[model samples]
Target: MVAKYVMLADTTRCINCKACEVACRAEWDTPLGYSRDWVKEVESVNAKGMPELQIFPGRCQHCDDAPCVEVCPTGASWKREDGIVLVDHDICSGCELCVPACPYDARWLNPVTNTISKCTFCQPRIDKGLQPACVETCVGNALIFGDANDPNSEVSILLKTKEWQRLITDEVNIGPNHYYYTAGKTIPVEVMPKLHERHLAGKSIESIVNPLGTIGIGGMMAVFLGAGVKKLVDRRKEVSEKEDNHEHH
Candidate 1:
């Protein structure tokens, strides 16, 4: 039995060229406005207090203790048989709730399809005995992928030999399967990109396309509210007219 797990990234080796992002887009035909994977450009303050830029390739961590799966009301999000966390598009209702539940911002609602999508660890390629698109396209060999459970596998060996750490936060312990080998104390936000505040500032259901079904719902709500208020005004007019008729009679 092959036990599936995650690969740790050695950030020191990454060149921030974004080959992984391109490969992912090409292979998946990701929409222009959204991506199943992303490369976050990070800038650190230099000694002169100027920003020094770096790039970090990020995707679904495929966490062992996944919070997205737990928070999802429909159970559309789940871990696959091989341990990769994935969303079942067939079951997803485009609620957009799971998007924020993910600490890594790994989940995204597809604007075209109106369903949630995220990284699947290239299960299709892995099943075919090929590396993930990102892993194969990495110019500097920065990304590595294999079974962490297998002691002889590349990922397992790397974890054992290298000083490594997992990205975590106290707020929500997602138990991210992705690991990192940075030569210093690990900060959760440092390993994961900081974009929640920005995302919150720009939050909207419009971020995900309004589906045909939802347009009716919105229209119905507006109509119902209008009719209810109009009915109340008409009732009040009727009562006043009845009192005047009774007095005249």
Candidate 2:
């Protein structure tokens, strides 16, 4: 059986140094303004009105039922058997259709490649028997990565002994593999998953065009036709609303 790769983030140890973000950017050459990973710090008051802080190191959840993979017009966004979800640049259409499908907002269009880019757990380095850049450079040692299936692995040990949580929501449970050990602190608002926060661009099209029926040129034509009709309807509604306002005047 293939190893189940997972990450255990010890939020108690995170110092908000952002070394992980810098490491990922350096390793991937991620463009300015967009990166494959991030560190979020949320400050709030407890019930006693005392100030408290929580920090989260975040990336793609690499979900088992990834909405990005399900809504991909092409089979470009796919998951390997080992559970890493990746984008095949050559097969992607640059349609930005998968942009809105991720609840975690993990996927983005790479300006350089005109293809989707995201965190892959540094799969290349992992294949080379090295830790992910973020994990390697973590100054606080908050980030831990390894195959969760291996009993001796750090991730597996953490899972067995420590209480952990994911950024999962009750409404949108997708079987995310990332685990968080917060040491009983309230989860930061910045790190919790919000399904309504997902972009609507790709999701709107997916709602209208059935993926199973989209088989070839005929399906492509349906997308165009559906979009045209929607635009026309919106235009007519705008005109009618204008006419009603004019009459009221």
Candidate models: Cα lDDT each = 0.76, 0.85
Candidate 1's error at 18, in angstroms?
0.8
Question: What are the root-mean-square deviations of the candidates from the true structure over C-alphas?
Answer: 10.4, 14.4
Error of 1 at 138 (Å): 0.5
Residue-level lDDT for 40 in candidate 1: 68
Tell me the TM-score of each prediction against the true structure.
Answer: 0.72, 0.80
Q: List the residue pairs that clash in candidate 1.
A: none
RMSD of 2: 14.4
**What's the count of clashing pairs in each model shown?**
0, 0
Q: After superposition, how far is residue 93 of candidate 1 from its true place, in Å?
A: 1.2
lDDT of 2 by residue, 108-154 (tens): 89998889889999999998989989999999999999998789988
Candidate achieving the largest TM-score = 2
- For model 1, how does the per-residue alpha-carbon lDDT over 1-249 read when each residue is reduced to its tens digit? 756868566777788888888898888888997778776666677668987665567788887777678666689998876689888888999887777767788888888778998988888898898999989998877789998778899998888888877766655555677877666634436655333222332234334344545887899999999999999999999999999999999
